[model samples]
Target: MCQDVIFHEIYSAGLLGEISLGLKRDTVEGLLGEPQDISVSSTPYILNYGSLQLSFSSNDPHATLQSIHLYFDEIVEFPHGLQLEGWLPNKSVSAEEFLIHAEHFNVVLEEDEQHTFKNPQIGFKSKADVIVVFTIEEESVKLYSIHLGKRPR
Candidate 1:
């Protein structure tokens, strides 16, 4: 299948994950297995990745990814296509930077106690449904998380 490029920012500043945008549909499929689903409008196409939703404009390049929203995961934006080629000392800029570039709306990062990058037991009903439970060591910020239902509601 053919698709506009998509990106995701599910990792923290210190973690490792590659979520690029404006990727060719086949390229994205190659990187992310395949979109959980797909939708289309007159001038835009949507591809649903694991927890990432991408929107592309027909006015943009063939693989021009417009934006990405990782709904529940803390990080949910991307850097402009130019900055990556510079010396940023980052895997893909910082979470703070991605937010500004994404023009984030009324989203909030709960607490280190609310989300984690390690062994997070996430489940899905479709692709958007997520249940996250995490904890932070009061002084150190060591994080732990489990599936929402593994314990209870």
Candidate 2:
């Protein structure tokens, strides 16, 4: 149970609230408040804000926010433009179907070797901080557990 949990809408350019790649760690911490858990014993710091997990790169002195993972079961919303092909949480859809619809948005979700599909263009690809990831099981994708990340340059 997280106190002061807020529903930050995901924006079309792969932004979750004020969070994005290259954002300083403190800025993210300020926006989300104290994380329920912080794994600081690793190179890339991991902060858990309830069901939403954020990973930060340690290469920078400030530990910039690198990626964000949100659970479908978690209570969060996306702006109309950022919604994943209009697929909402708890909505059942097949992987193939999702891939087809994503194409219309210029987002191509290709299955990776890890049995997941990812679209690099989900965010501002030019900045390399935006990507959309999905996990599939039994041909159906879980609405929760979707990941969005920006690579640390």
Q: Who wins the lDDT comparison? A: 2
lDDT of 2 at 121: 16
Error of 1 at 146 (Å): 21
lDDT (10s digit) by residue, model 1, range 1-153: 321112122221211144444455554445556566777563567666544566665533355555544443343333222122211112233334433432342223332423444443212111112222332323222112211111123
lDDT digits (tens) for residues 46-71 of candidate 2: 88775677888773547888777765
> How much does candidate 2 score in TM-score?
0.57
lDDT of each: 0.36, 0.53
Candidates in order, TM-scores: namely 0.34, 0.57
**Candidate 1, RMSD to the unseen true structure:** 14.1
What would you estimate as the lDDT of candidate 1? 0.36
TM-score of predicted model 1?
0.34
